[model samples]
Target: MNATVAIIGRPNVGKSTLFNRLVGKRLALVDDTPGVTRDRRPGDARLGDLRFTIVDTAGLEDADKATLAGRMRKQTEEAIQDADVVLFVIDARAGVTPLDAHFAEVARKIARPVILLANKAEGRAGEPGIYEAYSLGLGEPVPISAEHGEGLSDLYDALREEFEKLEAAEGPSEEAETDIVIDPDADGEEDDEPAGTVDRPLRVAIAGRPNAGKSTLINKLLGEERLLTGPEAGITRDSISVDWVWRERHVKLFDTAGMRRKARVQEKLEKLSVADALRAIKFAEVVVVTLDANIPFEKQDLQIIDLVQREGRALVIAFNKWDTIEDRTEVWTEIKYQAERYLNQVRGVAMVPISATTGQGLDKLMEAVFDAYKMWNARVSTARLNKWLEGVVAHHPPPAVAGRRIKLRYLTQAKTRPPHFIVFCSRPEQLPEAYLRYLVNGVRETFKLPGTPIRLSFRKGENPYANKAKKKR
Candidate 1:
């Protein structure tokens, strides 16, 4: 296992900035606002020849145990316990505040090796703060500027020493070797591979509005308090991804921040969180949009579902908090009616009612997710598609446009995973949008592709007689 390093400090001390630098990417959200980070986020980090798992945690703060700030502090404390080393950072330009001193005392009590980082010590202004940090009793301060990338060499030396000590105590680790064999007798050619059957983990992202129990659902699935949750809305800020196996199927689940309407989202931090959640949707193969059973099929819920369909991703609507509702029969009937009414564009989408808190309907939710994944990756042979197309066209021929009937000559699936298809037709541009929808719906129904997005395009068929006539001339 790689060495784990956790960066902990008071709000606005550049812990996230240092994390981004170590990871060599903007994996964590950075802002000038205090307490932007709320959960512990981990990323694989590399510095020179050294490699380790670096964790970016929420700023350490003092608050009531029931409050949101207190919950954030708990997450940071957990990171400190899990890490092999702790980077206790302080803002050198601002000098050490009382909160810093208090956390310094807290860090001293932890058993892990603590590295005091006097961040923002790029110039003479930070020199006094660096000296002040020495009074914290952790050790000599390592002056480094996390933003401008200064004094990392010294920081690396400090970390290297700690890691060397750990290695000595734990003993050397053996490296695994992978051998690849090539076939010399076979001709080199790339073959079209099928989808959904690969050994890689299935990427499933859970998204919904605030307090929709997205984090709770993920925590229940993980069987641990992996994510910080409370009665507070928007407890989650970053889109955190967790890896797990469900019934021998490897799955990478992304728990995204709650998305609110644009008009209501006035803060820049909330905007960043919403953007992160949208990115998770784009990366996921299947998105589970959690909905509160009390207020099912809200305007925002439909909008989120529409966005997923527009992004050409497989979608499953999970009505969370099912245990809270008393009228099961009436509510379930209304849910089905509303789903059909609002989600007619993507017909036959999977809707599962689940209680994330009680684990009720959890099995059904997973089954729906896997089913949607399979449908998303479903592919059809060209022969079968064309044969299906013949029957479709014969049953309902294309309407005449400008006294000429448009003909669909052939249909072929361009790709799977939210299946895209191209149709060779006459006057492709003249095909009406209504007819296109008809064809898309036909494909969805005929191919048993429910809950997954379908893409259909029309292209004018190439005429062989035109080239033949030119050759004759």
Candidate 2:
């Protein structure tokens, strides 16, 4: 594992800001509101030339053992335990509150090294807190402005000192740390694996209406209460991601807040939560829309599925709380019928009946997830695509448009992962929308790619040398 650094602090102490700064991406959500982040998020961080794994954790809070804040503290403690170095952050503008001191005491007990960071220290704003941080028994605080990107060089120096000591203690290594290298023009002949391997983990997001047991399902999959779950409708506010291995495949599971309809989402926090959930869906390769078995396929549920299809992501439908139903066979048949009748945009979507509380039918759900993802990334050779296109045209040719028959020359796939195809045709703008849908449906059925969005476009191909010939004339 890469060296781990954990950032810990009280709520609104700029931990997420520092994390975003180091990682050079807005992976974590930042807001003026406290407790916006409720989970431990990990990312690869770089400081100048130094690189390491950095973890951004929820702020420590004092609460009873069973409460949500208590669970968040538990996650923070776990991050501190696994971390090689702890970056204890404080809001320099606020000047070291009682909560910061409390968490600092806990950090001091740990055997690992700790570095105090007085964030928001731009233009001498955090000078008082820098001095106050010395009383916490940690080393001198490194003043930093996480928002403005200031004082990072000094922080880098301190981190480099710690890493140098670690390197000295662990001795030297002859082999390189990583074998992967970027070469834009290199051919594929040197690689040993015949088929390319997907090194990046598959990103799957579980989204649905409130109280659909989305978090409960992922917690069961992880075999731990990694996320906060309860009877509350809006218990989850952030789109939290957990890294897991399922059947030896690395999968990054994102559990998003329950998405409510636009008219009902009036609260500011709920709006933010819904936006985060939509962002998760956009980032995900496959989305499993969970439904309450008691009230399956509500208008909001169909709207969520429609959103996923419109976003061009592969989809799987999951019926949650299946153990509550008395007549299982009849409900299952009805649900399938409704899925076909209602979700016409994404045909042949995999639907699995699962009880998140009881852990029943999870295996089938995962199998369906993997199957849908495979179809989403599937690609067809141009030769086979053209042959299929010929058959399709021969069966049902394009009708006459304004008295002349429109000719479609050929079709070729432009991309995969929601396979996109472009057809060279005459009068592309005049091609009817129904004809395009016909071709898209044909592609889906012919390629066995079901439940994945397929894009088909018609383009009039122009001769490349025509411009040059005209100039010569």
Candidate 3:
């Protein structure tokens, strides 16, 4: 097993910057604002030859047990308990404050080792603070600058020492295995895997407006309070991903921050959060849009759904807080009507009513998710597509324009995973928008493709004899 290390500190001491440096990616949201991180985010980290699991946690704070700050502190405490080693960080420019000293005492009680980090110690400006950090009495402070990437070699030495002692006491562990294979004989070329055949985990992202219970739903799926959720809107600020095994199938679930309307999002931190959520949507194969049953299909909710459809990802609508609704039958009927009326582009999308707090309809939600994924990766044969096109053209021929009829000669599927098709036809520019819509709807209905975007493009057929004219002599 990989050694687990946790980075702990008070607010705005550059703990997240160290995490980004170690992981080699900007997976966590970083800003000048205090308390931006509220959940524990894990990533595989590599420093020189040492490899381990690193977890970034929320900043430590003191507050009432019922307040939000208290809940955040609780999450940090959990990380501290589970870690094999802890890195206690402090701002060298500002020196050690009362909060740091208090937390230092807390770190001392940990049965494991703790490395003191005096961050932002780049030049002479940080020397005084770095000297003052020795009073905390954890150990010799490792002076480093997380932003400029300085003094990491010293940090690596400290970590290597601790890891060596740990290995000596515990003995050699079984090395973790991986499934990727590297080829030594191949030239530089891209090897693309076919859809639905790669042995990778299925990626699913949950998104919606503020106060829509997105985190609650993900926590329920994990069967633990892995994510922080409460009677609060926008408690989650970062797009955190967790891996799990659902019914013997590997799945990766991403819990994103709640997106608010553009006008209401005035703060820089909220803007960053919204952008992070958008990135999660682009990376996912299937998106589950959570909705509050009491306020189903609000203006913002419809906008979110439209964005997902435009992105060409498979979609499933989940109506959360189902237990609080009084008239279930009436509400469900209205929901179906609204979905059909507004979401006519991708018809027959799956809608599942669930209560995240009570675990109602959880099984049906997973089944719908799997069903949508199957449809998203579906492929149609070339012969079947041409035959289907023939029947469609015979029933309703293209309308004549300028005394000439548009003739569609052939049809073929270019790709799957949001299936895209190409049509070779005469007068491609004259084909009306209504006619294209008819063909798209026909493909969706004929091939049992629903709730996924279908892309169809027209191209004029090439003249086969044009290149042969030069050889006529």
Candidate 4:
């Protein structure tokens, strides 16, 4: 097994900054506030030629065993136990505090190969803290400015030395290796369509209003209380991402804080949480908008769905807490009718009835999520698109504007993943929005693409002699 390194430190000491530096992605939320991270997140990290798993853990603190801080501390302790090496970081600008010393003692008791990292040590100003770290009983401190990407060579050397010693002590074992190849053109045709692959992990985000059972549904999918949940609204603050395998297919699930209406969101913390949820939706390929079945399709819920569609993300509507509702048939009919009438931009979005509390209809929900993802990344042959365009134009032609009939020439798919199309025609600006919507709906229905945003752009076809004629004139 590859060596795993865990980062542990007191709050606001730049552990998350260093974690993001090493992981090469901002997977963890970083802010000035203390205790931003409450759960452990792992990523594959690379330094020079070395590759291993690196875990970013919550900050350690002194609190009652029953409190939330205590639970975070337990998570950090668990990460330490599972790690082959530990990075105990300290804030060089603030110098060592009592909390640092307390955590240093805890790290010593754990007896793991600990590397002392004096973060925020960009210049000579951090000298005092570097000197103070020598008294913590850990060896020479590796001073680094993770945000500035400095002193990583020394950090790499320290990690390599420890990893080598461990490997030498354990010796070698026989293990089978499998090679994974990624082909860029695997998802589309070679002629006109862009090539891609679905082998990547599905990125799904669960979002809705506060206390809409978003976290509850994710917990049910994980089959564990990986997330903290209760009757309390807005229990989730940071957008926590968890990796799981469903039926041997890789899936990355993001549980975000519930979104509230802009005017209703007053607290600074809740605003940050809502912004984090928005960021999650922007990054996600498929977003499952969870709603309380008892009060489905509220104004806020409609607004959330509108935002998702505006972002051009594949969407799935999950009616959470379905078990609590009494009249299933009537509710389902109303939901279908409302979705058809209201969400006409992307018609036929998948709507699944689920109970996050009782684990009902989760299978259908995931199946719909995968289906939406597939359709979102779907590609159509140019020949097929042109044929469909021909038929649609024949059925209902483009309207005339100012005594001139707009000529519809040709259509070609420019991209996928919320499929975008380019149409070459005359007087493109004369086309009405309703006419464009007609073409988009035709493409969606003809190609079996549903629940995914469709984009169409019109361009006037180029004339070879136009430039020459302009020059002569």
- Supply every candidate's count of residue pairs whose N, Cα or C atoms clash at under 3 angstroms: 0, 0, 0, 0
lDDT of each: 0.90, 0.87, 0.90, 0.87
- What is candidate 4's lDDT per residue for 1-473, written digit by digit as tens? 48899999999999888888888987777889888877787888988877888988888999986777887787788789889999999998889899999888888888689999999999888889989988898889999998999889999999999998998888764541543445655866532432122345678999999999987798899997677676767768878888888877778899998999999999777788888899999999899999898888899999999999999999999999899989899989998888888889769889999999999999999899889988888889999998988887888889989998888889999887789999999999889999999888888888998768998999999888999999999
**Positional deviation of 195 in candidate 3, in angstroms?**
9.1
What overall lDDT, based on C-alpha atoms, would model 4 receive against the true structure?
A: 0.87
Please identify model 1 stretches exceeding 4 Å from their true place: 176-199, 467-473
TM for candidate 2 is 0.87
Off by over 4 Å in 2: 168-198, 266-272, 381-409, 461-473
Q: 331-446 in candidate 2: lDDT tens per residue?
A: 99999889889976898888899999999999999889989988887888889988988888888888889999888888888877788899999898988888888888888888
Report lDDT (Cα) of residue 257, candidate 4.
88
| Residue range 383-439, candidate 1, lDDT tens digits | 999999999889998999999999999999998778999999999999899999999
Query: Can you give the TM-score per candidate against the true fold?
Result: 0.94, 0.87, 0.94, 0.83
- Residue runs of model 4 more than 4 Å from their true location after superposition: 25-27, 93-96, 121-154, 173-199, 228-238, 262-279, 382-387, 462-473
Compared to the true structure, candidate 3 yields what TM-score?
0.94
Candidate 3 wrongly placed segments (more than 4 Å):
176-199, 465-473
